[model samples]
Target: MTLRSKPYHWLYAFVLIALSAFSVQSVAETSMEQTGELQLWHKISLIFDGPETSERADYNPFIHYRLNIIFTHPATGDRFVIPGYFAADGNAANTGAESGNKWVAHFSPNHTGLWKWQASFRKNRFVAVSAKVDAGVSGGFMDGQQGQFTVSESNKELPDFRAAGRLQYVNEPYLKFAQSQTYFIKAGPDAPENFLAYQDFDGTFHNDGHKDDLVKTWEPHLTDWKKGDPTWQNGKGKAIIGALNYLNSKGLNAVSFLTMNIMGDDQNVFPYVDYNTYDRMDVSKLAQWEIVFEHAQSLGLFLHFKTQEAENQGLLDGGGTGLQRKLYYRELMARFGHHLALNWNLGEENGEWFKNHPTMPQHTNERIAMARYFYENDPYHHHLVIHNGIDYDDLFSADSHYTGASVQTHKADFSSVHTAVKRLRDWPVINGRPWAIAVDEPGDAQHSLVPDRMNPAHNNARQNGLWGALMAGGWGTEWYFGYANEHSDLTAQDYRSRDLFWDQARHSIAFFDALDVPFQRAKSHDELLSSAADYVLAVPGEFYIVYLKDASHQPTLNFKNFSGDFEINWFNPREGGEMQQGSKTTIQAKWVHKAKLNNTFNLGLPPSTPNQDWVVVVKRK
Candidate 1:
């Protein structure tokens, strides 16, 4: 049966809840119900019969109670302590319930074996905010419940996260899949950050009058949603889900969204029951979000969770990692962190880059504190990054725990994307590790990635932004729609607005994948080329990829110290296909003076388009 139909099994388990009492010890006497496809990398949920609570409870179920499960793979003794949340009615996504006695924890087992689990439910005033496991007194129901289940090998295949396992940071310039060990390159849209501010969600954001004009219906993509996908409240999520379908159809693989944007650009998105409430979560709304996230995972989409924006970065505890901020992170982790591939972005355009603004920007210490919390708490230890408004100097220090950088450049033609990516990839850290850099927002705010109709050729973007980032050792890029243009970031509801550009992005991504480029081991070596206008990524004597913005410039490669014959092939970044032979197909190494300026081998011109951008691949034959 499908995942959406598995919740029906909870009905048979709820029968045990009727026998349990509210007393602390009595709840522990009951048995825990396990639901979900019991397989590797699939979501395994453990439902408990806990104390009854509502979203509007005076005791505040979110902050007063905590549920953490210690899941262990007995064979290897590897354990993961995952956080849990209160799932109202356990079927909130379908029933739209606001209260229930069900508390649940979701876990994705990485190994196939007999896994054991134990729940540590606790309660106290503000207990959920603390990081210590023993912070509060024993919660009455299922406080010390123990259970075990079996996980078999996953039956999933390509494009599904289950097949590749978790996406992890392995101290390299790109993320790698735990199971496949294949390096990843993310290319997708970075705009419409308020993607979750849908009118169909169970929230008041549609009529909240807070940037209400920015609310998205995603109407244009509704036709993209296929039958038997997923929807909530009886077919409510078709448009948003279809939008993801459209992206995946274009060969894009990542999407960014803000979990909470209160007091930010679009205030419609948040997890709270109301706009002002921070402690109480909107259970049904979050459940609906889970349905969408699950689908994205199956479709091979990397989730970039921009937790907050510049305006709301300091909204909780004045940017300090205090009670409010900790609870917020806890809820987010408990609800969505179990996904196989995702990154926890601290904030979008965070820090004090704006002059004379009323924003309370996060200081160096506060930023480090936020990164530290995610580093210590998240079980999977997903990639952690912070977007920069001015610079990443604060996180460049030895004390910072960030694993990557979300770059935003301010160039209208996106000319700075190459330099920005190279700067971050070469930034020296105390640990001596390179950061996985992604040019998330490439161009300036005024005209970043304009609509396809307005700029059909996408000359500047394709030449400078897309190829620019890739040729500079960047892991990938996500285009940001400028607010000054049509189908702007906050106002975009159709993915087709930039249809032509998506093909260009797909061509770039497909080149590396189809050609089996060893990008993870390669570094940007523009100095090895003859012209400053061109870019080159190479592993020295093994492989080389040169991006010539103007193919007419007969730039040469420095093969002074190289000692093997190499074959050259040209790839069209504008239109992807099989690699074609260039004018000069081969170059043999020859002895030359080390101090000579002309020791480089001539790189012959492209067979056809000498004026447009082209990528040349050179490998030792």
Candidate 2:
């Protein structure tokens, strides 16, 4: 599909203004760098002049001024309907301006070639309804303007998001990068839920000790901050950028954060003008956040954007369908939708968990509406999933916008990770589409993946916590800091607290990627294996991957109706090592027409490392 020019094309005159790294044009005013140095997947902003505004409190500029830049990549004929936002001022990051005429359309080209674009700016009058109603003929200066630009090859270093091109959801169980066409496997921190509660951010959490205790300086990561990296208003975000640097240095690829946690734990982070306000967004604060997120993207980190924490489920626009909720969703998609890799989690532990709270709880239909709204409005339609309290079954529907499940468990010892992932992975396939399931939060309610000083071995964690999820065909696992530990989930300042556990997680991700295992094609089947401690993920006779918790005994693989010659390789799970070569094996099925013995063979293979955990890989030869 291509983004064709709007009607009345002859009325507006197009002028090719000289730029450094971008090409921009409009009827009245345009702002963009020259396209000579643009790279694939690098966010480039095309600024345009709009109506001047003083207050966005009563009427949200996000919903009222709907500016869309329809971009068409010439080489591939791929079209992207990118949203535009009202940037209070062109330099909102430097100067804290809440209202102005600076409007912008951010674009990150998936392909390296010339791309054409046109803007469709409209004014909607209603703030109560979700649909758009025309506000007469007169509009902003840059409405219906068109132009084109070019994108060069990415010179971005490895482990950087700019190097990955666009991260797209291709109706599969995982997200894939447009450049390499490789599926992503996430492994990182899911805690420090208040990751955005930075000291420099323009907000205060000084209401109570619970909120104030979680305020972060990010001091440990200060050394990782580079000279030319994104820093706002002198040195506002060195520490937060440094935190992402620390995560990338540790080989972690994803991080989760609550953008708003009003009336909840760490009630510090919100996009509103202030803690009490909800109509308008804090432009300067959001701009600073963009700096942090942009740096994270450059580091190749997957942003798991947890939009709302539990307590604020009904706080916005009458529990989802009202104008407040619509405005919030539209603003998020407008500002950050151009990001290469991210997921908009509807709400953390969403649904009616709080009965005695002041606000009305969110109903099932409201949650569905929220997801459906994002599915319809967001042009990118990046992975849209909802976090759960306990009951997530109602949210699963082929018609809904939930592309995956971000599960949270209360089970102690995390023994439930395997079954939970298995069921979630299998149930979606039973539905119309497959879901990319991840155990975002797992383990006990207390002491989950604490410092190495407390739990160094991490036997339960390695065996049940990490391996169980992977063995069940789970996409990835992120460590959730428990409440009972020091620097717990909300108050974690240093990421090194769970350093050893990260090593184990990275080893698992490396094992699959290095082997080039067709994990997406594999299915988890516990019925094929005899031992309860053993888990099998196989693609029939093509490939079989087995994970043994107790490697002392061998597990039987019943090749009932299959005949194939296979090569076996074993990998140590606890201690990361190369795939050890094993013997070639054959499984013969029963034969009748050929006059052969009518019998099947059940192969029992010995463990590579006895009494220790191991992963056995069998490939058809």
Candidate 3:
């Protein structure tokens, strides 16, 4: 039916939500022959988990989401009628195991909406009833067998259990949150220091933050305490204090305190413990963090409260049936909304988790979504991020718009993140957001692929744009990788090498300060490489940056549509930034680069004789 333009004009408002759950098994795999190298599986999965309510936390991880699907054809019709296709689709498993005959749906009071759903298996069909999804605020539908259960209105006021933190959204307090590095140590119900032998801080914190602590790691006073002696723990605290005070003493702008329930029994510093919510002590920032943040403020350090999530080994005895993941996070953000010192660190080394248990994806999404949620809607609006392991390229997807990307990658973990950082930078998924690498390598961990005492790794990553985010308002934190020796009665001095490494890591920091770079939000360009070629980008009114794969022989070739007087600043990863003032404009200079470069310019370098790559940043003419 057609209506007159003015005759039909009217104001209207409505919301309609539809919940349809269906299960589909892998159909016969379609085999497509390839004439070239084979790449497979374009199967995309949307993730979900059981309702994230603390009450069901005993059965459901409060931080988990179901691997659910809600895909719209955008051009809806027969697509809606497909058996396994629903407005909201999901995996058969709720959290751990598959539910034979159940699904959840939500519908909003809507109009002009017509749809259909199908399933490969009959039992996977969805039954509907009214339930309240407090977070989504959409009317919920469940398997018809259970009837309907109403959430007591009073229960709405019940506290939403959450990670330790204060929410800061857009510099406002709209939510609460937590951050921690406990995945590297312990979890849930113990003091963070108990499980770890010590911390490793590089020289950047020197003078500005932990400079003195870098010196104190070698100070003989730390070993004075012994087991069964009150002084033993006191001595550990002293060591911690020395390190912390160094940050206070330095003019460093911010801090992230390690907050988690991890048990430390002296000798074995790097062990995970099991502790539930109640079993875990009140070591959360709610109590002790205030003092730390306050002290940092007096010394002028932005306080960033940190915590971690359900790292399995660190006992999570939180036996609740329902927990409001969103509200819990909001409450944390709301609690500490006003403090600039609070940043939401969802987890450390969490991005590295392999999706072995694919059905448990919602849990993964929930954890990841925790950071996404915090960064998206928090009040404090402080920097919200997740700690990605070295394999960031595989795990970090382009979702969420936040402050920056913080990573924990060592030499061992750092398998050419160029592609990963490329995705992190230019992948269609994540438009180029800021990126930072918080290196904690060459430390006390004996098995480190990149040892803790290795300081060059620190500067190398920094100068190479791994930590360039630091230059672009990107902030990085360095931890001295260490562990307590439980088997050795805590007498092991495994930290010396790394301690010395931190003392020397300052060279990188000083290098960063002197270099002219944009870490957070710099413009990037795409160009083809030929040194054997090079990838080069010429930023208008700025520098010409180039990243070469192999620097065998240097040839100044022709640049299409490029002519100007340019000064070349070749990036020497070994010696830092060196500028070679080109007297003439036909620029051909030997330079080094990190992650190589976003721009690939052709350099007439010989075939794979194998020379380390370099970057040339041509300053403004």
Best by TM-score: 1
lDDT against the true structure, each candidate? 0.88, 0.76, 0.32
Q: Give me the runs in candidate 2 sitting further than 4 Å from their true place.
A: 1-26, 29-37, 54-60, 74-77, 127-130, 133-137, 204-210, 354-358, 428-431, 582-609
TM-score (all chains, Cα) for each model: 0.94, 0.88, 0.45
**Between candidates 2 and 3, which one is better according to TM-score?**
2
- Positional deviation of 21 in candidate 1, in angstroms? 12
lDDT of 1 at 615: 92
Per-residue C-alpha lDDT of model 3 across residues 216-314, encoded as one tens digit per residue: 242433443234322111232334333334543332333343344233122212111122232111112222222333333434344444444324212
lDDT of 1 by residue, 468-490 (tens): 99889888899999999888889
Q: Which pairs clash (backbone N, Cα, C closer than 3 Å) in model 2? A: 20-34, 21-33, 21-34, 21-35, 22-33, 22-34, 22-35, 161-300
Best-fitting candidate, scored by lDDT: 1
**Residue 172 miss distance in model 1 (angstroms):** 0.7
Clashes of 2: 8
lDDT of 2 at 168: 75
Which window of 10 residues has the lowest lDDT sum in candidate 2?
15-24
